[model samples]
Each structure stands twice: as C-alpha cells, then as structure tokens.
Target: MDYALKESSTKFETILGTALKVPGVRVDREQFLLQTLGSKIKDGNIVNLAIETDPVTAGIPIDKLDKIANSLIKKRTTNTSMLSFAAGMPGGVTMAATIPADTLQFFGTAIKLAQELVYLYGYGEIGNANQLDEDIRRELTLYLGVMLGVEKSAAALRVLSTNISKQVVKRTSRRALSKTTLYPIVKKIGAIVGVKVTKASFAKNVSKAVPIVGGIVSGGTSYLSMKHMGHRLSETLSESIYYTDADYEKDFKEVCNEVVDVEFN
Candidate 1:
C-alpha cells in the first residue's frame, strides 16, 4: 500500500507536467487582460495601461475584476466538464485512470482559470506559466493546494503574497521566494497529492458501469470541482492578502473539506 502511494504521488507530479503542455493552460497576463476587458474598456491604450500596471493601480474597480473572474470561471468550468464527460465514457481511448486524459485537461483548464483570476486580482507576471520552473511550481502548488484546502499551503501563500507586495524590484522578489520558505510547503502538497492519486480519487469521478452515466458523472464532477476551486483561488487572491483588500484574510486559509467524490481503489 505504501509503495502504491509513493508511486502514485510521483506520477501526480508527472501528470502536472503533462498538463502544462496542454494548449491555453499557460495564460499571458497582458493578452488575457486585453481580451477580457477589450470590448468593455473601449480605449485601447487605457486597457494597455491597465495591463501594464496592476488593474487596481490603474483604477479598475474591484467589482469589475470580480465580474471578469466569474465569467472566466464559468467558461473554464464548462470546458473542463465537457472534456471530463467525453473522457468518462466507458471504452473511450483515454478512459483508463493511468493515462487519465480528462484529468490532465482538467488541471490544464484549472491552471488557466487560476492564472486569469490571479491577474484580474492584481498580481504581477507569475513567470512563464508554461515553463513551470521551481518558483512557478511552488506557486501553482500553493494555488491548487488552497483549492484542495491545505492549511500549510495557504499560510505559505499568505506570506508569499505579502512579500510580493513589498517587492520593489522583480528580481529581488523572485529571489526572496526562491529560498527555503516555500519548499516545505511544496513537499507537503506533494505528499497530499500523492495520497489522493494512490487512492484513485484524485481525478474526476466517473462511474464505469454505465457508459453514458460515466460521462455524466465525469462532466458534472468537473464543473462543480472547477467552479469551487476557482472560487477558492479567487477568494484567496481577492481577500486575506495584500493584493486587493486591506484585510485579505477574512478566513483566507479556510478550504472545503470535500473537493470531489472520486472512488478509492
């Protein structure tokens, strides 16, 4: 059992790497902001200016950002759910849990949602989302971990978010986060994810007995899961942090007890 747990956890890390390769998972902050606000903002340069600087710093209202984030979450949720349903169909090419194409796409979509929400809430460029370096990995882990309701990960994010606000220069801030501060948290996340994977409950829950039913379960599960995770990250970014509200922590570390209903092996 312990061996299976370790192997599954190791595979979870690889699964994330594969997810990054999914197109559109890596969101460009400027492009996303421009596209999201373009039709509404009207003025090209003003929108450009907003993208260059933090939206909040450029006087974009918090309520406006919230609207954009909600739209993004909805769109991504629908997309992920559809993919999950398709993958969940029994005898589908990627139905096997080992490969779990739907699971990969789900994370990919979730990452994009996370990026958009982070940008909308006024965070700086989080580095190459595609590249997924150590810092980016740690950052993404924290965001996903928060969605999974990990306490230590949230505390790490709180500290990192505060430090990001204090950063006068990009290099200096990146350097600060690249140290021992976040490593332990990342390790904890790895262990947790590993356990989830080994239990076969990490991906979207699909009932294999009834082919169509599996699709329904997969799709429905993805939609609800993504929506909640998106909201969790959104709230974390918006409140209980230095980015948006003066007091962001209004229960910033709080997470849901049940994130999904996947069956255990």
Candidate 2:
C-alpha cells in the first residue's frame, strides 16, 4: 500500500510538471485580472459596477467565462503548427506524446480560468509559481481541486471560507489548510485526475494513430474536454458564498467534519 501511494505520487508529480510546462498560454493577463478584481472587491466597486453594467459586477458572468474558455480552448487546439511542433522530434517521441502535451496545455488554460474565477468570486491572490510560500500553494491547491470537481476540495473550501469569515489572516488560513491530515486528500485528488488524464490520452492516442487524423482527433478531444472542465469550474466558483457574505463558519465546520470523516485510501 505504501509503495502504491509512492508510485501514484510520483506519477501525479510528473504529469503536473508537464502540465505546468505547457507554453503559449499566458499567465500575466490572468494575474492582472486578479489584481483588478481584487481592487474592485476591496473598494466595494462590484455593486456599483453591477448597477452600471449588467448583473455581473463582482465576477465575470458565467456565460462570458464560458465563451472565453471556449475561445481559448479553440485557439490552443486548432493551431496545427503549434500542436505538431514537437511531434516530429527524433527517437522515442511520437504522436502519442502529443496527447499529453495537449492535455498539459489544457491544464494551463484551466489554471488561468481558475485564477480568474477565484478572483471574480472575491478570493485574493494565493501567490504564483515563483512564490515558495507553502501556505499559499496549499490554498491554491484546494482551489485547483475544487475547479477539478473534487468533492473534498469543496469541503476544504467551506472550511477556508469559514476561516476567512472569522478574519483569519492569510498565513493562518494557509497553515490550517496545510495540515498533514489534508495532504492525502490533496494527493488523492491529483492522483485520480492524473490517472484519468493518462487513460484519456491513451484512448485518444488510439484514434490518433494516423498523423493527420490524429491532429484532428487530438484537437477535438482537447477542445471538448477543456470546455467541459472549464465550465464545471466556472459554475462551482461562481456560486461561492464569499460572493455574498463571509458568515460561513458554521457551514465550514460542518464541511470540515465531513471531509475529516472521508478515508482517502
């Protein structure tokens, strides 16, 4: 069992590393969006913005997020030159590898969407890749899990929400979230997704045996999968209680208990 856990952990780390390395998708724009939205949240400008504009003052409207996510996914998948850039490489690299590359790009898109959605829903910056703060990383990980439709992530979010409502400092919130107890849940979520992505890649690769047909198949798969994941995340983040109020302690405690009761293995 210990060996299995270690193997799963290693596989998840490798996949995550590849996903993080996918280039072309921009992070600066998302970070800037977070900064702008953060300011709006601080100044209570959301109400005024909503009053002036449509009903979407706090965060980007779900419909708009959907459209943007679709557009980004399309751009990433439809660019044949970009998709095939690493396909023709010598020795050991083949069309099968492109699926993971595309999957990584999709994850990059998902991360950007997560950041934007989190900010829109009123959470502050959890730091970026360059930051070494474990607390911030842990917090971000919880959000990522939520975006990926992990049930435990929802419980963790509720707990974090409760903490924030009580005026918990970012550091303290991070500390609570970074508890050794929660590590397995986080790892489990990552491992599950890694396995899913790997399996999906293999299935997609079978369809992609022919290079020309493979590009189309891979692009379509990336497009549909990304759209599905992005929309799921947008819906979950958009309905956050943080958007309305911070009095979520009771709710958070309930969720924390439920999360604690969940046996990971």
Best by lDDT: 1
CA lDDT scores, all candidates in order: 0.65, 0.51
Candidate 2 Cα RMSD (Å): 6.8
lDDT of 1 by residue, 126-233 (tens): 775343476676677777777766555565566554324321223322223334534544655655765654444444453756788778887887788889989888
Write model 2 residue lDDT over 27-113, tens digit each, in one string: 453444545444434444654453233224444555654454445434433443344333322221422253455555556566665
TM-score attained by model 1: 0.78
| lDDT score at residue 72, model 1, on the 0-100 scale | 85
Candidate that scores best on TM-score: 1
**lDDT of the structure predicted as candidate 1:** 0.65
State residue 77's C-alpha deviation in candidate 1, in Å: 0.7
